[model samples]
Target: MTVTFSYRSRQTWADPWDDYRALRDEDPVHEVGDGQFWVLSRFDDVFAAARDTATYSSANGLTTAPDDMAGFDEKARPIVMMDPPDHTAMRRLVSRPMTPRQVAPVEDLVREFVTDKLDAVADAGEADIVEALFKPLPSFLVAHYLGVPTEDRVLFDRWTERIVQATAESAAQDGPNQQAFLELFEYAGGLIERRKADPGDDLVSGLVQQGEDVASAMWIVGFIFTMITGGNDTVTGMLSGSAVLLDRHRDQRRLLIDDPTAIPNAVEELLRLTSPVQNLARTVTRDVTLHGTTIPAGKKVLLLFASANRDEREFGPTAGQLDVKRRIERIVALGYGAHHCLGASVARLQCRVALEELLGRFPDYSVDESTARFAAGWSTRRYEYLPLTTN
Candidate 1:
């Protein structure tokens, strides 16, 4: 038996869990599109490849789509597309502000955002979770964190969504969105210039001061774009996906509602289940053999984090099932090693705070599955809109 998969296919994105299981069981190291790329679906294999950055490089591009992979000088690529010393240096420029300790204070602001949104829906007892809470909360927090002016937050939100959609379109092989890219780059440049002169207590200002000479102006703009897209998009997926998961798995929801301290760990379980970032492509630096397949050098290899998270070898027989209390020793949901997501702490903080507030307030809330619509994306699987009824 053989399982075929391609990131460019809508069917693959529609539902990949079943195909992932087949690939893991039959061919852990599977090829797609006549050697377009190789996929590593097993937990151990994906984990090893992600950590071994030297062998599996991110310098070429992080996305699998050929169209999206073009037109970027290696030197000026986003931090996600850089490896080691350069990636290390670029990441350090803004790491301090995103650390767990640094983001602790941001939790209060997150709680406020969640509380306010949930409050608006209290009277109606029904609202689209994505629209009411999940969507705006992340954008608002990101705007505050980056020091974007309150008046310009609307523009920030619009730009982030456009960029994220453009990304999805590229992944689906729908042409690249040059307009969105240019618009965001221009906006980010303006913000960077403002930060340079004003120097506020925000991530952008910190990057300008620290990277004034160390990094190029374009890199700073790229960093800001990375932060904006990463902060807004992934967090929304995690929260909205968790809502759908919890709504389906009421037992787990009850557990979290019963014990709020368990929410943090539950967040991890949800991340693993949701697997917001489905997979990212890494350019292979050397010919690497895994599970009887020798993937040649200069090949694009995708580390299927979503499949690996549910791998039974590492997660036991109930890997496919949702178990919020399941003690997870390790999971590649956020990723691993040097390229691990920089905005991870901030994302976790936002999701944790959102869940704590949402569950506490509307424990009986049920998702109107008929109205639920998920994004048609390859890299990230998230809800476009999820209607909820508290009745």
Candidate 2:
């Protein structure tokens, strides 16, 4: 059967949400077009498929891996792609760094990183938040946390941009990024070996303590690239998106200024509503039925997490409202179940700290809509650059 990928043709940012909404009301699970795959847009359907690894597979790789990542598949050929026992075993190596007990101690580091980045722009008063603020926080933190030298921070920042190249122009413009990745990989591989010899008090040291060998060593390097790409770009998007949303919702901005405690929950609400990574693909290995549609194996299904976040069936009437107080757990934007984001806590902390400092330093910031840009891919959406001005 010839698969007619509707999502790819005549694309628009809203097309995914629009199609999902239409599916939820009319045919929640049906063939979208001739020879096309089935879509499951409702909350229960997407999560059920995501949780059930028996049918859906992450092995052929999540198609959302950006095109610019040169050896990304070979590099990412680690736990992120693994399903069962393999995924479980490898995930255990660095699990402690992300839990609450582990993360709390890093709060000071988070604040320090936030302070320094914000300080870079506090004097300018008018800087592109993506370039001046959002871009560096994770770049700095990722390098710092991974034991990469401070001097290499600039190189890390550039390589991450290339690996995350989402638009046609940026993709075309990533020749330098490709070269940088080769140099960075060799440099990082050597760094990984150095950590093996004399492990220190850093996250990479912890990986070494876990008996990380050459394979695990490679995974660690790949993880850094993946984490920076995923954690950095997504957080940057959320921060940028929140800046824009707050600009539109002046009253919401007031609420934040009045009560800074709302910031944490506000982060979750923003994460749910913004939905940076739109959908992830899973190819079926065995014949199975999902959301009332049968897959005869060897077909890919997109778990539209962005659509599932707004699943009216689960959220009731206020599903779409942006309520800072509202708790939005069970979001798949970070992936759900066993394969859920291992770095979720770090990502949350990054977003929280980044925004907190932004607000504290410049409680009065406005988004310049004319200068904002969005990631090009229909599958994984993020901000290209979010320009803001402080008044």
Candidate 3:
């Protein structure tokens, strides 16, 4: 049986497990658009391809859409679209501040932020957690790092929404939201210039001082774009989606409430189970054969991180089920290999702190399923609104 799947399909966005399972079992190397691209659904296959950066290049772009889809100039290249040495150097420029040790000092700050959010809704007993808590916390944190003033922080959310809309389609045939891309691009450049004259302890200031090259400035703008969109949405989705998951899986919720220490492992498990950034596209550098299929050179391949996270071969028979205590040896939820998420340590820290405060304060919290609404995007899972009751 042949299984048809496209990242843009609404059915794929709503529920893709059955199709993922079919593709994994019957056709691990599934092709779409004849020779346009391929989807790797198995854990091993996806991991291997991610590790072999030379064979599966990222130079073309991560999304299946054309390189120019986002309306950036030909010279504009985000770190996500580069490979190896250049990618390494670009990532290193800002990687220090995001490392686990560096972000550790900010735990108190994060907890304070989380505590304040929970306090606002503590008495109400009911609130849209997505809008009230999960959404704003990450936006605030990202803004804090980027040195964007509180008044201008709302722009990040607005910019992120438009970017998501641009890539919501399979091809982005009409081209990406040009206005949003240009608005964000120009905003980042302005911010960098400001930081250069008046250096601060923020990430942007640190980056500006590190370089004076035209290319570096271009990459910085692109990197900021990546951070605003990927950084904000990934954490928001994890928290909002996990809230719904824990509500459905009371047993797991109980485990967390009973032992707060279990929240860290539970965060990893939740990420593996509910991967927010479902799949990322990579262009094949040369012909590569997996199973019985021969994917020719210069084609695109999507590493199905969400599907691979649930592979039975890697996680055993209960792969599809949620296990708060499940020991995850290796999961591609935040991606794998050379392109692993640079802000991963920071993301984990926020999710861990947020869940700790949330479950500790409202152990019996429940999600109001009827009012829950998810954003219309297939690339990354996002919640428009999620109502919750501290029952």
Best by lDDT: 1
- Candidate 3 lDDT, 1-391, residue by residue in tens: 6688876443335577888899899989998887778999999999998899999888887777655336655455787888998888777777888888899998998999899989988979989998788877777778778888667777866776667556554333344467777777788888888888888998888878877673467766776776777787788888888888899999989999899999999999999987988888888988999998999898889889889999999999999998999989999999888888888888899889988998889989988877677776767876768889988
lDDT of each candidate versus the true structure: 0.83, 0.71, 0.82
- Looking at candidate 2, the ten consecutive residues that score lowest on lDDT are 1-10
lDDT of 1 by residue, 73-171 (tens): 654579988889888987887788889999998877888878988898998999988989888887887788788998998877877777777666553
Question: Taking the tens digit of each residue's C-alpha lDDT, what string does model 2 give over 1-391?
Answer: 2223344311355345566676667766556444245566778888888898867778666663323234555644656677887777777776777776788778888898778767767777787788877767766767777887778777777776776663322453366766766777787788878888888877777776676443477777776666666666666666777777777877877787789889998888888877776677777788777555676687667777877888877777777767777876577777788888887887788878877777777888887877676766645555666777777
How would you order the candidates by TM-score, starting with the best?
Answer: 1, 3, 2
- Model 3 CA deviation exceeding 4 Å by range: 8-12, 66-71, 155-157, 160-183
**Per-model TM against the reference:** 0.94, 0.87, 0.93
Estimate candidate 1's alpha-carbon lDDT, on a 0 to 1 scale: 0.83
Give candidate 2 misplaced runs (Cα > 4 Å): 1-11, 14-16, 30-33, 64-76, 166-174, 209-216
Best model per TM-score: 1
Evaluation by lDDT, superior candidate among 1 and 3 = 1
